[model samples]
Structure formats: C-alpha cells, structure tokens
Target: MNSIPASRRWMYDRMYTGRRGLKESFVHGVEKFITIACQQQSYVNEGKLRCPCAKCQSTKIDGVHTVRLHLFKYGFMSNYYIWTDHGEEMANVDNNLIGASSIGINATECETSNSMHDMVCDALRQHGAFDILENSNVEEPPNEEAQRFYNLLSEANCPLYEGSSESKLSMCVRLLACKSNWNVPDECVDFITKMLLDVTPVNRCLPKNYYDAKRLVSKLGLSARRIDCCVQGCMLFYDNDYGKNDGALLQCKFCHMPRYHDRNTGSSTKKLVPVKTMFYLPIIPRLQRLFASVQTAGHMCWHYQNRSTSGVLRHPSDGEAWKHFDRVHPDFAADPRNVRLGLCSDGFNPYIQSTTPPYSCWPVIVTPYNLPPEMCMTKPFMFLTCLIPGPRNPKAAIDVYLEPLIDDLKKLWIGVQTYDISKKQNFMMKATLMWTINDFPAYGMLSGWGTQGGITDKRRLYGVGKVTSPLTDVDTLINVSSGRATEESEKIIQLEEQVRKSREEARQSREQNKRLQCQFQSLFNVVLPLLPSDTQHILQQQVDQQSHDNHDDQQPPPTGHYGDDY
Candidate 1:
C-alpha cells in the first residue's frame, strides 16, 4: 500500500464530480479521489489514515494505506465489517458475504492508474489478450458468486501476472452464458479466449482452443449430458438396454434404424442421416434443486394454501375447471402438499426461413401449478421436461420422446422420498399431472382428440355443452314465471308461514303478560298494606308462583319449524 499526499487527494476529489460516466476522469485522478475520500473520514489527518489491514491495525499503524488498498483490491462493496466499534481487524471478521472472495487480488498496482479500464487495458495488451468485448453487447452487473469464483481462479497463480487455465475456463463460461448460441465455431471461440485474457486480471494463461474450454465446462457439471437417439427417433439411449450397457445396440430395436451410418459404405457421409441427439436434463434433480432452497420451496405451496379463492378466475386455481378436477379427484386433492402439473407442448420452426426445407421442433414443457397463481406460469417456475427433436413435426408420435418423462412423472405421482429443505425432514414428495394446456391443433394431437369433426366423449361433451332451445310451451313458461312453486318452493313458503305464526303468537303472549303484570301491581299495592304480616308473606308467595305458571304457559317459539328452514 502506497501513502498518497493530501494535496493529490484534494485535487482528485475536486476533479472527479461523482458522475457515473466520468470513468476516464476518475481513472486519471484515482489516487486523489481515494485520498480525499479517506481524509473526509474522521480518522484521517495530515499524513495518516486509519489502517484496516490485519497486520497494521493489530499494531495501530495509522500511517498505513490499508483502507485505500482494501478498496482497490476488493472493489467497492468490500470491507463490510471494517467500521465496527471494537475496531476488529479484517482477519478477525467472518467473510461470508456473497461476492467476498476467500482470496484477495492485489490491486495496489492499479492505484497508479486513474481509471480501472486503463489499468485492465494496459495488462491486456502486455499479455496479448483476445478481444472478447466484440461478442458481449450487455455487461451484466457484478455478481457475488461469480466475482468470488473469478477471484479464486485469478489468485491461484497470480492470474493478472500469469494467467492460469482455471481463470481462462471461468472466462469461457462467462462468454458462453452471454453468447446467443450454445455451440460456436473454432474461430469464434478463439476470439472469446483472447477477449477474456485481456480483461481477466492475469492475462497470460487461457484455454488453448474451443475444445479445451468445452472440456473444462463439462468437468464442472455445467453442461447437459447428451444422449444419442436412433436416426428414426425411436427412443433415447437412456434406458439400461440402450444407454447403460457396453454392447448396447446402435440400431433402434423396434424401427431397425441405425444410430449412425457406416463410414465404409459407398454412400457419402453427407448423404447419410446423422444420429438424432436428445438432451435429457433430468426433471427430478431440477425439481429437487428448487426444494433445496428455502426461498423457492416456501413458494411451491402457495397455490394450495395462499391463492385467492375470489372465484373470478384470474388464475387457473380460481376457475371452475381446476375446481371441477379437484372435486372429481378428491383422493389426489387430499394432500395440499402434492404438486399439480400442467403439460404444455408446442411445435415451432427453429430456422424461421421460408425458403428452407420445412422442419419443426417440439418442446414439451411442464409447469408446476403449486407456485403462487402470479408466478405459476412464469418461465422460472416452468421446467423444460423433454425435447422432441425433429426434421419434421412429431405430431402424434411425440409420445415416443415422452416415455422417460412419463416414467419419472409416475414415480413422482407415487410419492418419491425427498428431503424437504423448508421442513428439514425426509418425506414422500408426490406430484400429479392435472391437465395439459395447448392450442386446438396440439390438443387434438397430444390428447388423442382428432381435430376433424371429432366429438370427445360425446356423452360428457353433450352434458357440458347442452343448451336448451327456445321453449314452445307458453303454459310451462308462464308457470315458471308465476308463483307456482315446486316442492322446495312450497316447503320454503310453509317455513315462512310458520315463522310469521310464531312471531304473532310471541307478540300476543308478551302483550298479555304485560297487561297481567300491570293488574297484579295495582292489586299488590292496595292489598299489601291491608294484609297481616303472615298473610302478606303467603300472598307474595302465591303471586310469585302465579307469575312462574304464566311464564311457562306462554310457550317457547316452535323449536323446529321456521328455525330449521329459514
């Protein structure tokens, strides 16, 4: 860490107006800016600033430029725990904050440059770094995990000083993620490699070629495993007989289609149809990944417990269709924890060229309806369950690609044993395929409902679609309109009559009782003084008994008549 003069820091602060786009200006005045920022803090004085370095702060080295060095090394968001009341050293604090690297990159050299770009650019040219910037139009904001990973690779061998293979591989992954295409040409890969080397801290070591980059990504489990399929698209080389065995048949057993044409054959390799490729990214693992995180796992049960039931049908759960299915299959609906899924399959032309030969690819997607209604159909919540590759649309034959997925769905339906992260327990995780959502064409193909004049389950269909014609029977219509009542209506009328009668009787009883009370009061007031003490006591007893008998005789309202109906 170099000690910067106060005058330089003041000048840098004055020159840099805190504009985001003034990187060039800031870079030229970087030292001054750091000095000014540090001086403004309460601890900085004429020739000294507070030292946050583990070694210097331990000995209270006020003269050390630990604060500036830390900033330059770790970027802006570093040293979160440096400003504590106890004045703890960097080594003493736990560094679990995201993007905080286990190892630090030395940025003291960069302090000489006015801007970060200038420093990085100088290193790029010296190291013969490729220009990967050409392919990247959007620069993603710095991510903590990515930063940590990048720094880890850089620190392995003083990466900025001497580039390492690990650092190059990290750069490769970043390029691939940003690139539109999954597969790129050799020349393109070379260009990306050069660009990464230039920008990466250690600009020397990078992948020799595209193959090397791919090999590294595969080893890291970041690439999907590809399974070869029969040229006729019979089945994926995934099952035990096809994929697992050493002497697995290359030809489709059912269709007798060769997986690959023999090179020795008189036919040109270009004339030979290539083996179909199927990328089967297992859904169970993907789903399990969702449950492994507390944030998403909590949301998985939103539909069952938290979805609105306003009956306006803003979401699928609020509609009659979802409720009908649930009502019909009470056993499946018994557990709110069980996931309900909707299968959506559609075919689209990938090339999007009218002049080219017609070809379409069908992607089978599964969406968990268990997420909150708002997020249920969202891209993040939906999983690409299967891909039916094609030079032609699979149409009805799409079921062939669905076999593996179906088997998995069956296992999930039967309740596979899974660890629930939210509950922190091992439990049977059940999922049900509730419905398939698709366009009219896809619905017919996927659901065996023929598109041409086909009535699906005519009896049920008629029941669902039944519409009454205009009534010719005026008398019946008039009866419906008039007060002519059915058994239910007559019963309701009878109940109403009973309620009225009850009310009338109660009202009459109350009036009679009040009149009797008035008469009794008049008699008691006049007779009380005339009676002897013994006689008065006897008379009071008689009056109390009479009142009790009258109250009992009034009768409680008929218990079962209107009360039960109304």
Candidate 2:
C-alpha cells in the first residue's frame, strides 16, 4: 500500500457511505461491538460462565446489549451502540454516540462531514441521545472496615500535597493500608496511611498515636459524607524529597499545578501540595481520563499563555481563538505559522472551578495537546462553543469492563494487597481488565482524532500527504496508487518499519477484540447449553480444594489477554 496525502487521507478516511444495505451494515456494526465487549469482558469455562470475582463463585448473567441506529447526512448511514441493564443507560441513545459523526468525527467507522455545525445539529436531532455518564456523586456508604481506613488517612500527622477533593490516590492509600493490616484494625490504618501518604516525620505523631486516633474516627465509615472528594482531580502527587530537594514543584497532577488556599492564612502557597506518586489514579474511568488530559492542556496551558487582543501570538492554531486573545501582546510561534496565547487574569475567585479560561465548564477536557485559545474572549460565546467531546470518562456498567469490577481504585488495591495466593491471581486478572478498559479511551484520545491537535493547516502550511480515491467504497482503508515509490530503498525500509509496527498494533487490537466475540460464541454456542450436569460436577472435582497449583502463577488470563504490557 502506498501512502496517501494528508487531505485525501482525511477525506478518504472520514467520508464514505457503506455500499451494503444500510440496515444490514448497521446490524453488523452493533453485533461486532457486542462481540468485542464480550471478547474483552470474560472467558468461557468447562460448560460454566465464570466471572473473575474472587468470592462470588456464581455464574450469573449481567443483562447488557449493544444496539444500532441509522441517521441521515444527506445520505443514509448507521450508528453502533452499547446498551446496559439500566434503562437510563439507553435513554438518550442516538445523540450520545452518533452526534459527533455529523461533526466530522471519524470514529472507528470513519464518518465525517464538511459543515461541523450542521453535522452536530443533524446528529443531535437525529440521535436524540444524552451522555450516559456515571456521576461520581453517588456511592454506597462504606462499612466499618472501610471507615477504619479513612480515619487512618485523615489523621496523617503531616499532610503533604493532597487534593482538597476526593481523588483516587487518597483512597488507594487508605484502602491498601487497611487491607495489609486489617487484623490489627487499630494500628493498621495508621501504618498504611503513613507509608501511602509519606508524611514528614516532623509533622508529629507516634505509630501508637496513629493507631489511637483511628479509634475516634472509626465510628464514621467511608460513606458518601466521608468520601467528600472523588480523588480523580488533576493534581499529581510527588514525594517531598523529589518535589522540594529536587526542584520538583508541587502541582495538581491533572491541572499541572495549583497553589493551595491555606485554611488559616487564607493566602495561597507558592509551594504546591505534593503527594507520593503522580501516575494517574486508576479510578478515573478510561474515557474520563482521556478527556481530562486534553481538557487540562487547553484549560491550564493555553489559558495562561501570553495574551494579546490583536491576534494570537505568532500563529496559534485557532484563528478565532487567536483573534480573541490579541488583547495585550503579539501572537508569535517559533514557526510563524504557529500561534501563542496572551495573558490577562481577573484575580482568584473562591468559587472558581479551574484555572482554565472562562469558557470551559465541562468536567472533562477534550483537547490533549495545547489548544489555540478558544473563541475571541470578547463579546459572548455559547456554552456549546466551549463544549468539546473529551476523551471518555471512567464510570461505566461494570459488565462492559472485565471482572472484579472496581468502583474506586482504592477499594481495588485493598483487594489486591490482602488477596490469598489464588485470589491474588484472580485480582490481577481483574486489574488487567480494568487497565485495559482504561487504556482504550487514552489511546483513542491520543490518536489525535478526538481533537484538532495533529490537524494539518493547509493554507498556512500544506504539509499534505495523499491517497487518491472517491466515495466509492467505505469498507476499506485509504487506498494509495502504487507506482514504484518502492524504487527508493530508504523509503522502502521506512515503509517496512511502519507496516511492521502497524500490523503488530492491529494484530493486538484484533486479538483483543476477538476475545469478546470468542467468549460469547463459545459461551452461547458451546458452554451454556451443551455440558451435561454430570460433566460440570466432574470438572469441579479437579479443584475441590482452592489452593494454588504450584505453577509460575503470573500468567495472563487463559483467554482475552491483549494487555497494556503487550
């Protein structure tokens, strides 16, 4: 396959109409989605449907399905979906999935439109969909054990960089500490909190004092009231050793850096609140993480750049956003084609949600790379103007994700720490699934399709690549005309390297996708109805005792194993 030009590639990749019957094509899409879901979620056993739950040894079906709908773009097209047991999950069906298809969003289907506004409106009207997002606002109150863990964390004699809101790191530290020392309930919480938080010794408190304090807070469980924050904030926590001595400034992991508002002084700290770790708090659903990453880039980075009302510095990408920012300085980029932001602030407000420009209000961030400041910050802009399709959020029907479903990563890590040998493996498998579910949104977001980061600016700089084709076939990839570009051995070598890498990724994607289909085909076609009762009993006999089989236990799931590691 020969490489295509950028414009043609964009047009070819996103604009197409399936030649097959619209209904049939739509059906295939939905079926494939369901097949993919199953492939990713579970495995089949000897005539039994076993979820990877450590204690819940029952085989029960979690009712979920994916549906497809059709729409018009001056031409007929189809939409694929994932439905859930909850009716609300399907309430705003069309708008939720296909809305972007109208606005030039080249999904896995590669659908696009010329007029962004028209495409979005068409999708909104046709799909009648709502965002089926899980709100972190709701939670089942934690029990005594879970409460003990929170109290331990609350009394960390020294608080380093901690998000004011409930974030995953806060919870994980508490959960794992509780599990590791669950037996000495009094002292367990303190020991774990100390290790997890890594507070300064000068902050003051004894191990026994740590244990004693928990006794007071133990009465209060880790309920919604206690779980004040979602722990999925933008701040990245780092050890004081790194943050202070190593010139690592304390900053919000998600937002980059946020100065803390002191409780007593009411003054902001030049120092950032640092934490022990900075990797994402796995609690953020994968989709949300993707959106947050991009959104933060726009909100924090772009918003603070040098501002000028004349036009964006140098050549910020968004002409409109650039024009809006030309209030104070010249918009300059190292490349004249590039754009930079100008700065101006309205001082801090107590109710401020983020450091992002005023127009952004949505919780999730859509653009991962630096954004050309949005809109002319003058006059007025619509909420819709700032609204962007961010990477997906983390919350979902646990069924869509693989088993040992973790509502909060803190809880999941606890399960990991205390899991018996046999259970540990099971927990790891579940974690793998969680991580896999999370990885997709990140990858999908990073593919540069979600936002206009890698979008080529034709007029400013036509670094256009090409693939010549018409809207004749939508089922295939961009087709390039083959003339002996193969004559260039160096280019040929590069092409070979590219193909090798692409194929490996595709194979991994294919196999990961195949697992869901295979699991379902094997389940409904073989395991569910075929095995006689006597056979199931005999199979159970092979492992009557739940002990580890002296094998090199760290194997991937027997099935559905395309992981982040690969």
Best by TM-score: 1
Tell me the whole-model lDDT of each prediction, alpha carbons only: 0.51, 0.28
Give lDDT tens digits, candidate 2, residues 1-566.
Answer: 02222211221222336843344443444444335335422322222221111121111223222011211111222221213211123233433232222222232222222233222222222111111112211123233332333344334312222312222322433453445555446455666557745654432332334434434333323221111111233322222221223124434444454334334465564653322221211222221211121111122223234344675454343344323223222422221212121211111223456764443111211111232223322211111111111122322211112111122222322222211110111111011110011133332222211212222222112111322211111111111212232234334445545756776776686566558656754664456346787876765555343223512232333433122121
> After superposing candidate 2, which stretches have Cα over 4 Å from the reference?
1-24, 41-61, 64-315, 318-343, 348-369, 372-566
Error of 1 at 349 (Å): 1.5
Question: What TM value does model 2 have?
Answer: 0.19
Quick one: best lDDT, which candidate? Answer: 1
lDDT (Cα) of model 2: 0.28
TM, every model: 0.48, 0.19
Could you tell me how far off, in angstroms, the CA of residue 210 lies in candidate 1 after the best superposition? 4.8
Q: Candidate 1: list runs displaced more than 4 Å.
A: 1-173, 181-186, 198-225, 233-237, 240-247, 265-274, 320-337, 454-566
Tally clashes: model 1: 11
